[model samples]
Target: MSHEARQARLRPTLISFDVFGTLISVRDSSYGAFERILAETGAHRVDVEAFWEHWEHRNIVHYCKPYRTYREICELSLEETFVHFGLTGDGRLINHYFDAFPRFFLYDDVVRTLDRLSRRYRLAVVSNIDDDLLALTPLQREFDLVCTAQRAKGYKPDGALFRYLIEHAGCAKEEILHVGQSQFTDLVGGKPLGLTIAWINRRQLALDDSVPRPDFIFADIQSLNDLVEL
Candidate 1:
């Protein structure tokens, strides 16, 4: 279907969001954390970009296992990345990364976009994060409901978290729109479950045709206002 047709069909009562890369800016924060740790260990020459990609892949892999605290998952993933590069994984460095969550800012458009959308649609967050870690972010109070992997005991690409949102929202799957930046988790996970998926391609990345396509695509949260009229 074309974007206009999808837009016409979308009359969501609840807008579910993936917090990390959607509302909050994870890329910069992750890079900063990795850079600091690398400098501390005299591994500054290592490719931080590649390190982040590996760490993220490992984190997603860990999410598939029995649920662990997001902190534990982060520590484990960081350790895996360190071992991959033959660097000693320092406990303090792991703690630094864990503590850095509160410092990560939202994208400039997030608050305004959310505020506007909230006037029309109830907002909820479904994240592959622990409750405590999610509480540290500025987005903790922005949603009508917040579901985490820690609470669901499962992560995205599994549909457990999205199911939780559906149940809690007291709405049909068609009445909710799940929006996020991760194609593998959010799009692939939510689309199969009959929820309308919105790919928030903030970075303008090309869509991977192998995965399920989102019903709607927006460059950022702000673009949502154009598709969803109050």
Candidate 2:
């Protein structure tokens, strides 16, 4: 469907967001923090870029397993990273990421756009984080609903988290528009559940043909105000 037609059809009462890369800036900061940790720990031989990818891959692998808190998953991934690099690093080093994550800055447009959208629709957060961590962020705006992987016992890209969202959203699946940056998680998971998916293409990356396409695509959250007019 055309963008105009899709916009006209979408009358979502609840707008759900992906917290990390969508509303907040985490990727670059988290990588920088990881690099700092490597430097501080004296593991100068470990390549930050390679270690970042390996850690992320481990995290994603863990997501498919039964269930574990995000903190445990992070530590496990870090442990695996150490094993991969043949470095006897401290597992507690994962605490650095935990400490740094909650303080990560939000996207410049996030608060302004969320504030504007709040006047019309109920705003919700659906993230792959623990509640305690999420609460530490600047996003303590009394969102109408907050669903975390810790509460749901499942992470995104898996249908379990989105299923939890649909069950508690107090509305039809079609009435919730899930806006997120990750094509793998939000788009792949939410599309199968009947929720309208909006892709926030902040990086302007090309969509892979293997994944399901999003219902709407925007450069950033600020564009959502235009799509969901009052």
Instruction: Tell me the tens digit of each residue's lDDT in model 2 across 63-153.
Output: 7788899999989998898889887787778888888866688999988888888998998999988999998876768899989998898
Model 2, global lDDT = 0.86
Q: For model 1, which pairs clash?
A: none
Error of 2 at 7 (Å): 7.7
- Poorly placed runs, candidate 2 (over 4 Å): 1-9
Q: For model 1, what is the C-alpha lDDT against the true structure? A: 0.83
Give the best candidate by TM-score: 1
Best by lDDT: 2
lDDT of each: 0.83, 0.86
Model 1: per-residue lDDT, tens digit, 45-156? 8998898888899888887778777788888888888989998867357676667888898999988888888888898999998887888877746578888988888888
